[model samples]
Target: MSDILFSLPVEQQITPCLTLCKKDELPVIVINHPKAKGAISLQGAHVLSWQPEGEKPVLWLSPESNFKQGVAIRGGIPICWPWFGKAGDPMHGFARNQLWQLIAHDENDECVWLTFSLEDNEQTRILWPHSFSLIARIKMGETCEIELESHGDYSFTSALHTYLNIGDIDQISVSGLGPNYLDKVVGGEHTTADKKLTFSGLIDRIYTQPESFSVIADPANQRSIEIHHKNASDAVAWNPGAEVAKGMADMPDDGYKTMVCVETAYVTNARTVTNDKPQFLSATIRCHKNEQK
Candidate 1:
């Protein structure tokens, strides 16, 4: 740990507020700004945790998650890029599995911004043969925002797979997504939500052309989480439920009871990027007191 911290480039260290540290065997950026506290692992440029000064944690990280190289960290915001799901090899592309370079960072009275970059290399070429550059810019403060930008001549599907921490899955409801969705659990069958969504069992549905924002009302926690997105045509709502969670080695059997995924994505309609035109997908998250009922 001492060696890793000492070896960090001077430009990358912000001191007292932001610094490079080792978590297990992976390099992690620890944030201790006055307004919030958080951590980001370079392995995936993955935001592991974030908590505003007076609020509970907004992101969820699995207790059983592995903190090693080449393995997804189970929770938080995982970058599913280039292609989503089984559209390509290794599942969800290579962005989350590859180490990212921290190219820039800055802090201000309102927020701290960090930019991480990942470009196609020999390892990434073996997975998907393409010449490209990916940039992830994250802002942490009273609100958490992440923007993913792609520079290349290609069309691809991607997602900011954000896992949110809830007091209880059964006590919460999600709104703003329109009535139509594709249920992946039922083999991508088209379905309609018809109303605000409440979880009961395994729920994995892709809401197409939904509203720009979605809100999770959590009465149990006396708070609500709102996710606002841009440049995304789709949104995914997921909860593995009890049975599936039991089988996941990285998640506790009851993990589904406290976490829900409301992802910002471009799945059904892949975004195209050219040398002259770069594509972007972004999401901003805010947590506040729920309405009194």
Candidate 2:
């Protein structure tokens, strides 16, 4: 249906390597072994606007405020789990920037698939000290899906931090959190979120055992992205609130008007994968042209 370019821009970089390619015709950008720790951007992908000029590009991942070592932003369809910001691993895990190689790229005149993988590196070990392999695959179509598999170690935890752009936060609400949840910020106690998790105050919550939940509606796009996940038992919603927004190095004062982070994870007390099994995390996002405003 579409002539997707399944190739990354090839060039040399001083830090590590920056590859910009297209998949199923959609721009797919990736970075390898990024040092000095910069940012990565893909064309048309919704990036976080931290300044008036939007310098930050809403990095698909970020380090947690406290644990500045792990990954945070899983750009595009930010998928976060495992740690779920419960630990001190920054925003999530460190798979985003750990030198991924283009393992497979194929186009059979119909659809395209682009896969990238990152094995345990000396640099990463210094920070995480875990032996593992992380793979990220991006496929294009009416609906795009990215699948992450933790194939090496079983005792691992992580998440996909998707920064969704929405209209007035007041107009949005997330459903499927069902009834009860454990609030990590308030006191690691259980509470009831029977209705949609509304946004109003400095809301930071982690929900467990979600049946099914779609991301908040986007008034600008006039269409909502339905988020579906499997194997992940934890979900987190975060907004810097007001006070933290002012002190942010990359977020604008009014930036709060447009975006929020919906992270999917396996956080509680951390999860370990045994039996040589691959822990899987995936997100499927389909955009509706008919719903476009």
Candidate 3:
């Protein structure tokens, strides 16, 4: 685990809020800066929490989620690469289950940034059988940014699957996803949404032609979350209904009421990456008071 996870110099590690510790069997790095606070799990290199100063958390984490390797922790941003969902073995690709190398970390008065890397090895070869280097870069502070960079001579599908925390799931509405989408909830049927999406029970749709940015209006929290996408043409809106949510071991029976996943995706098809042409996708999530919108 020491080789897989990184620790800064003694001076940096001695900060009041920075931590490199093991949570159960998982190696996690916790942040407690004045501008923001969060936790990053080395298992899958997944972000388990991110909350900017004086506001609700931008990422939702299930209290029941396990903090161990091989299990996908339910929250923050999970990198789904080489494949999304059940399209490939291990469900959402091998990248999320492997230990990632912490390549860089830096901070300033306003924000903190951490970058992780994962290169193809014998382990990943068992899954997609591709040669590549994947990067998960994160910025935390006034706003949080997640970037996924892939370099290799193989094609892959990937996403920054972000689960946002809201005061109440029913009181939120998501807008800026273009009118049409592939309704995965209804077995991948094509549908049109003429208005902002308001969740009732379950909502799982792959929206097409989404604007570069979208808003998650949370009336209960008296704030709105802005999600920005880059280098990708698709976005996914999903929430497991009560029934399904109750069945997931990682989530509480009612966990679906406080979370929603809006994934910035390049998962419509496998994207080709040549030695000279790497692929990149990102999502930036920011929050502000409702009145400011």
Candidate 4:
């Protein structure tokens, strides 16, 4: 872990709330606001952690995550753009593996907002031949909000792959994803979702036209997490289980027991972005006491 501090254009505005530091040689922005605390890495513009005051962490991050360049950090929220998953060689697009510029930032009594931007370069064009500008705006406060916008003249599949923290995988239930989905673990077999989804083993399904919001009820933690999304045509639910997680070097074998991914996405159906009509995908997360339990 490197301890070198870097200077930002908005260094003065960042005082009393944010700091620019290096972690494992990658530039990171550490947030310490009155309402919340979090960290965002410039590499991929990935959000590594977030916790509202007086509450448990809302996101999950792998302890063994690599903080080096050109590698995807295993946790928090990863921005997958242009192409998602095996649509390209890098698995989940180049957006999350590239360094993004912090174009702007602001602070208010209730929230702190940071805007990061990435555009096509020779390296990115080599991976996917297209001209584009991507902007990720993050707001941290009592509630966490992330919005991704694309300006280009091309169609693409993307997702905000969010890994949520939970008390225990077995003690939680996720609801609001409608009845149908494509089961990826079964090689894309279509399946139906139960009223409330529970985890027992490897589960990977994509709900093409899910409801706009999903709630994770965690009785053991005495809280429920609500994920409200906008302009997303699909919702992805995933958990690798013990056997599959064992093969991953970044995540512990039992990591799946405490986390779940309910991603907001534009998969299965790609969205076309143009200069005249930019595309936007956003998700807002809030945690509340589990009143039912």
Higher-scoring candidate on lDDT, 2 or 4: 4
Q: How many residue pairs clash in each candidate?
A: 0, 39, 0, 0
Encode model 3's per-residue lDDT on 120-235: one tens digit a residue. Answer: 88877877777888888988888888888889898788888999888888889898888868887667647565669888888888887889998999988898999999998789
lDDT of 4 by residue, 1-293 (tens): 11122232333336679888777768889888889988899998898888898888889888878889999999899999888888897988999999999999999899999999999999999998999999999999999999999998999999999999898999999998878888888776465646888898999888876888999998888999999979999999999999999999999989999899999998988899878999999999999986662
Model 3: which residue pairs collide? none
TM-score of every model? 0.94, 0.70, 0.92, 0.94
What is the clash tally of candidate 3? 0
lDDT of each: 0.88, 0.51, 0.82, 0.88
The TM-score obtained by model 3 is 0.92
Q: Is candidate 1 or candidate 2 better by TM-score?
A: 1
Off by over 4 Å in 2: 1-86, 89-91, 107-111, 288-293
Global Cα RMSD, each model: 3.6, 8.6, 4.1, 3.3
What is the Cα-based lDDT of residue 23 in candidate 3?
Answer: 67
Candidate 1: how many backbone clashes?
0
Off by over 4 Å in 4: 1-13, 189-193, 291-293
